[model samples]
Target: MLETLGRSLDSAIRKIRRLPQIDKDAINALIQDLQRALLSSDVKVELVFKMTENIKKEAMNTTLQKAKRKDFIIKLVHDELIKTLGGKKAPIRIKPGKKNIILLVGIQGSGKTTTIGKLSQFYKSKGYKVAAVTTDTYRPGAYEQLVQLTKQIGVKCYGNPKEKNAIKIGVQETKKAMNDGNELIIVDTAGRHKEEKELMKEMAVLEQKLKPNEVCLVIDGSIGQQAYNQAEVFAKTTSLGSIIVTKLDGTAKGGGALSACVAANIGIRFIGIGEKIDEFEEFEPTTFIGTILGIPDLEGLVQRVQEAEVMPDPETVKRMMRGKFTLEDLYQQLKSIKKVGKFKQILAMMGGGNIPDALKDDAEKNIEKWRVVLDSMTAEEKESPNLIKKSRKRRIAIGSGTDYAVINKMLDQFRQMKKMMKRFTQMRQKGKGGMPGMPGMGKGAEQFMKKMSKDFKF
Candidate 1:
């Protein structure tokens, strides 16, 4: 998400990792590089200086030998980042078995309404009876937009286009949601401009009247330095209980928004990675820093996999364990990958060191091509790939609009996969355990592969 800043920070880390010895000069150079990166990303100058100062003091005072310097520096930077982006974890507060009210507020076009949709879907998927209520009567299409989002996520939405009173609508909808047995009530208020006092007044009324359990300030992550000011205003006007930074994906200034929120003392509760309704995720600062520094976020990856429900069915798992893998199963695997995320994004979560960006891009394209080729093949050909002769290959190539060589390569890949599966099955059957040396892995090898496929999906 913060690709520019991530690259800059990673560059400095790589330099330190390559150094045989880290001295005063090396530490100073790293700090300077970090300063440039954070500044360029619009992180507040004061916070940047403070973080660097802390890192420098700690590094200079450390008596660790040169051999441990690299690890120490990484840990220092990671800890400093976590401290800057909320010292202690502030998890989303949702009271179970009670009507939890979440009031979302932000400036116009800050993704407040869309974030409500994401939050509704998030809570709903967690087994809560969630309902969305739109009090944005001033915005022409705000109510309709929320209605459409709630319908898509299979949640109930309450709004009145004819009513001009936002607080009145909010009060009515919340009461209705409570009476209807909804466990979560998400209220979407009208987006206000900083200069618009009338809209702010309406929001204040709802804050007092509703006494929401959570007053979330939604800030657009691309706003850069302005994010700080926006967050401050919201925090003051509504006593912002938490913050949700939206549109972080593909934003070069995401670093600014996150740092800004932290500087304003607003704990980030969630981050909207994309425009999709399901793109909203809980924010974890340590994991986020690790992600930026090229470390694999195993926890976040697992969460996404679970959200996508990409686990292999028992029947499919049984078939693979029996060494009956086929092109159809491979097609299903590809579909699961698509369900998770883009290949490059998956690679980033798996630690960027494992795959170059160029290869990731090519692999993404190849995956789509593979799906098309599989689609072009007949059901019988997919089940019995051995039956596809030269004629069938040419026909499939023409149907899929791919070169014959691509099809041949896919077949070769399938052959390698089948061979691997067969060997793994044989190893388990012979009771030799995983890889002939790795102990305690009779069938664990296959299970590990399945877990990897589920988590990485690439």
Candidate 2:
């Protein structure tokens, strides 16, 4: 999502690797490059300067006795940048109370209504009884938009277009939601310019009336520094507890939202990565820094993999490790992987690099092909792929509506992966094994197998 800035930062960090030392001159050059990149990405000038200055000071003062200069510089930059982007993580406060209220505020065209819908959907998925309340009496379509969105999300919405009193409407909706057993009520206010004192005052009244747990300022990422200014004005007028940057998909200049967080002295709790309700992501500084630096954080990926449910038992894992992995295990793995989301997203979450362009383009098609091939297999053949005779393979291929070559390719890939796992198990047994680029003893595979055994049943 931060692909542009990520590429720029990755390139800048790579330059450090070629430097002889982290002297002042080298550090200054790197800082200059970073400043230029941030400025170009629409980050506020003052924020960029502060960030670069911190980076420069840290890089120049870092000792290289225990670590490489490049590694130190990268770590320093990552930490400082995260600090500048609001060091502490912030989460929405949904305490055990009568009704937790989150009031969303933003200028017109900032996607406030859409964000409310998305938030409702997000909370609904988490098993919260959420309802959307629109107090936007200014715009004609505002109430309609919110109503349609809440209905689409299958959540209750409270609004009355004819009600001219925004504060009264909000109070009534809050009471109704509470009486209806709604745990969370997201109030969508009319979008107004931060400069509009009257509208800002109205927002304050609504806040006082609703006593919202969170007053989230929704800023448009594409507006860049302008959005920061808007956030600043809003913060000056209201208690802006959290920030939510929207329209982050594609080539949006989102860095300004980070700058806004610094300017407004608020942490970003959620970011809109796409139009879909499920596209919001909670901000994690380390992961965000890793993603921006284009260094896939294998640790994060390993955690996600650990969260996934793989089939079979300790005996099965041991058998697979011993080169006896069957199609049954492969089928189970496929089902688990499918639960994790799209292949590309799964890879990204695992700190895997960008899929090759050709592979990326064909990933969905490949997945479909695999699903078809798996579906066509007989129960006996799937349990023991080696039992599939050539004639059975032809019949299965015909049944799946895919060519025999595609079937053969799937089998070949499965065999290759199984062989590699077998070799890894042997290496572990001989005290000479580990996954390539994996840290420590090649024990992660064994640990992963053991963990899977506990979590999954055959």
- Top candidate on lDDT is 1
lDDT of 1: 0.77
lDDT, each prediction: 0.77, 0.73
In model 2, what lDDT does residue 366 have? Answer: 64
lDDT by residue for model 2 (381-443), tens: 776777777998889888999988778866765675466556556655665535564334344
Find the number of clashing residue pairs for candidate 2.
Answer: 2
- Runs in model 2 lying further than 4 Å from the true structure: 18-28, 65-67, 193-195, 250-252, 298-458
Which window of 10 residues has the lowest lDDT sum in candidate 1? 344-353
Pairs in steric clash, model 2: 301-350, 434-442
